[model samples]
Target chain A: MADTESLLTTPLDSLHRSLGARMVPFAGYAMPVQYPAGILAEHLHTRAQAGLFDVSHMGQAEILGDGAAAALERVTPADVQGLKPGRQRYGLLTTEAGGIFDDFMVANLGDRLFLVANASRKAEDFALIAAALPAGVTLQPLPDRALLALQGPGAAAALGGLAPALTALSFMGVAAAEIAGVPVLASRSGYTGEDGWEISCPAEQAETLAKTLLAQPGVAPAGLGARDSLRLEAGLCLYGSDIDETTSPVEAALIWTLGKRRRMAWDFPGAERVREELANGPQRLRVGLKPEGRQPARGHTPIHAPGGAQIGEITSGGFGPSLGGPMAMGYVAREHAADGTALELLVRGKPLPARVAPMPFIPHRYAR
Target chain B: MSELRFTKDHEWVRADGDAATIGITDHAQNALGDVVFVELPEVGREVTAGEAIAVVESVKAASDVYAPIAGTITEVNSALTEDPGLINREPTGEGWFFKIEPKDPAEIAALLDDAAYAAFVESLA
Candidate 1:
């Protein structure tokens, strides 16, 4: 962990503190990991109602150039060229060697492409994209902006008044709107497997926007701890932990993000291995593990076949508050990736029986 | 004559003659956030002072519950298996992990009392 003194602070820094949040050093920022309500309550609340999260530490940027989309397509596997204005698509910046450098969201904002990449990889992503740009393309990082996510079944009800138009946006829809008179780029999307909106606004007005949303019925301030459990139950990948430079998209079961046209063109970085693996199937694939016991098989725990031979390793694991049981995701040999295949996770040097289960342990409640 | 004592590791020992009831301190449970599971030592298992005797898992991470003083396990808290959140709700009461027959009840005097344990928890902050 980086020294807290040197960590960056978001516009909601004082608000989080005032709300009695437990501050932790995360991705070079002094961010709240959980509020006084606690992670379990926050996770359960979001599933049942609404939860607000301060995600300002993530890198926000805009790509400007007549051929910006085409240029971006060269670095990422997602179909940037086909991304229509006011719509967002999940993206992956893959390495030449077929491993994922980072996963991000690319939204077409009419004149430019709005990008939100992981904060831990923001600096590296900017440099990578900048260096790959063809002549005339420019990338601008929005250091002066802050991002917040209002998520859950009750999200629309809570945010309808603040940003009237936001409640109508479909999943993955993006629009520029005013909330409490503050201009914001609100998107109908979130990491949690629930209906929600991610609102990007100028840093100066973030606190007001957050407070306005929190004042709504059923809206409560949540932090990173609940965020992690929510995403895990959603079966979404967490960069660096669940997916990284050493893992390929095919292996991570994220081949769906690869554009159909791009698959034929095979022109993006790492396209060869990605294409081959997509056709032939990877030797190992990421799968969800339902551990038989309550003890969570956390990251780096060795996974094995019934006979005690190592098959793979757990990348992310924890207690699923919604499921009321311990669940995990990890890479297992293709043979063991089939749902219901019996596997064992070595926790505390003891092999605990686990079974490969279909992901999204809890069904996603995203609004279509 | 039962008395409460604490260890540097944040476990509490309620000594009554040669037997003691043990549980993690409120301070420890608070630091651990939501307790999801508790793995207790089996009854009749002998454990040395400061040894890792049980395990407590929270949403964030799993932690070892150490023996505050040398003792033999006499009874384990079966209630925690069904409801581990008891640790967070009542760390000093219903959340007690197990009972042990201490090898030396005299060692209770060596552990921190209420005032000293409060100061110890303050030092951490």
Candidate 2:
């Protein structure tokens, strides 16, 4: 942990404190980890209702000019040039070695491409994107904007009351809208695998916007604690934990993000490894793990085969509040990655029973 | 009659003669938030003061529950294995982790009493 004095504060810092949030240092910012309601209640609430998360620490930027999309394709594998206006697509910034540098969301906003990168990697991501961009295109960081995610089964309903036009936006749809007369850009997408929206507004209006959203019925404030559990249950890869510079898209089971045209062109960074992996599967693959007991197998727990041979390591593991049991995700040998393959998780010097299970420990209720 | 004492680590001991019942304090449980599992020390196991004898896990992370005084474990809380939430519901009562036969009953005198512990918790805030 860094010094508390050196940590940055989000636009909603005082709002979180006012709501009794337990703030902790995350990605250099003092962010809320949980509130008075605790992680369990917050996790369950997000599943049953709506959770408003202040994700301002994440990096927001815009790539402008006619060839912006094409320029972005130089470093990423997503079909950014084909993204329709008012639509967003998940993208992975690949290293020259075909490993994931960072995972981000790129939204096509007609004249420009808007990107949301993980906070921890935002600085490096923006620099890499800028350096890769062609002469005409330019990267513009949005330092004065704040991002908030409203996620859950009831997200649309809660947010719909404020901006009814948001309800008409399909999944991954982005649009300029107004909530309580505040100008904002909202997308019908979230990381929680729920029907929801991620709204970006001016930093000054963040507190007011968050308060307004929380005022909605069945909408409550959740912190990073709930956010993490929800994403894990949704089987989403966390940037630093699940996928990193050492992990390739294929090994992370994110081949779907690789566009067909990009694969054929082999123009993106690390295209050779990705191409080779596509032709012949990667040596190890990421898989979901379901422990047989209540004890969770936290991150870095060694994974072993039935015969005691170490197969891989757990990247993200914890008690899935929605699953009401322990759930985890890790990389394993291709042969042991099959669903229902029995495995052992070495926890506290003892081998705990676990198995490879299909991810999304619970069903995703996305409004596709 | 049992006399209650508290450790700076937030564990409480109810001393009845040479027998001592131990559990985490309500403040500790509140900070932990929603206990999901507990790993108790084995019965008859000898432990020294300040040694981590058990583990208590919440949804977010796991923490060690230290032994506040030297003693031999006499009994373990088996019920907690089935209902770990008991720690959140009754942290000092039915949520007791274990009982021990104290190696030195005089150690209880050095532990904080109710008022002193209350002040200690206040200072932390």
Candidate 3:
């Protein structure tokens, strides 16, 4: 962790403080981990209603010039050129060896391709993308913008109250609209596996916009703690915790994000490893785990077969507030990745009974 | 009921004759929000002062509950296995983690009293 004094503050930093948030250093930014409501309440609130999150720490940028989508395809396995305007797609930048560089959301906003990358990897992601670009293409970093995610069952209703036109967008749909009289780009998608919008606006208008969203019925402030638990429950992967430079798309169970055409073309970086894994099957696979007991098996906990050798290790594990129990996701040998395959999680030197379970412990409520 | 004594680690010990009821202080519970699991020490196990005797888990992370004074565990709280939130709801009462028969009751006097513990908690902020 970096020194607190040297950490950057988001546009909503003062607002988070005013809301009684517990500020923590995350990805070199002073972000709120939770507020007075705590993680459990905030998580339940989002499930039942809506949560407003300050995701301004994430990097937002645009790709400009002709053949931008094709240029992006050189690095990522996603079918960027096939993405139509007014829509978005999840993409992964792959290392030469097929490991994931970073996972990001790329939206076609008609004139240019918009991207949102993880905060920790933004600098690296931008530089990598910029260096890979053709002489005619350009990468534009949007440092003057702030992003917010309004997510939950009630999210659409609350945001719809401000800009009714946004309600028309389906899941993964992107549109440019004036939300609360502020020009913004919003997508009908979120990491929480809920019906919501990821809205991007000018940095200066972020506070007013956040307050406006909070003023809407059933919308309350949530912090990174809730956001993390929510995503975990949704079976989504956290970049640093679940997937990293060494985890390939196949092993991470992100085969769907590997565009069909790209797989056929086999032209992206690290294509050989992905192709080999696709045909021969990955040695280890990311799977969900449900501990029979209440104690959570946190990240790095060794995983083993019953009365057998160590197979893999837990990547991310914690209490899933929605499930009202402990849930986890980890990589295990392909033989033990099936749902209901009994396993043991070595927690605190004790082997705890657990079983491989299907992900999205709770059903997703995305507005598709 | 005897007045509660405290340790700098935020554990409280309520001494009653040779037996003492132990639990985390309210300040500690507030710091560790939304307790989800409590791993209690086994009865009859001998513990030394400042030793980690139990584990308390919240949604975010797990913390060790240290022994305030040396003692032998006489009984453990079984209710916490089912409802760990008792630690947050009643840190000093129903949330008691265990009862220990002290090796030396006089050791309780060296721990912080209520007012001193309160001041110590304030200084942390």
Q: Which structure among the candidates has the greatest DockQ?
A: 3
What is the C-alpha DockQ of each candidate?
0.81, 0.78, 0.83
Q: TM-score, each model? A: 0.99, 0.98, 0.98
* Candidate chain B TM-scores, in order: 0.96, 0.97, 0.97
Q: Who is ahead in TM-score, 1 or 2? A: 1
Residues A282-347, candidate 1, lDDT per residue (tens digit)? 999999999997888899999999966999999999999999999999999998899999988988
Give the residue spans of candidate 2 off by over 4 A.
none
Cα lDDT tens digits for candidate 1, B1-125: 47689999999989766689999999999999999988898898989998998999999899999988887899999999999999999999999999989888888779999999999888877
Which parts of model 3 have CA positions greater than 4 angstroms off? none
Q: Candidate 2 - CAPRI tier? A: medium
lDDT winner = 3
Alpha carbon deviation, residue A201, candidate 3 (Å): 0.5
DockQ preference between candidates 1 and 3, better one: 3
Candidate order, DockQ descending:
3, 1, 2
Report the alpha-carbon TM-score of model 1 versus the true structure.
0.99
Residue A61 C-alpha lDDT in model 1: 96
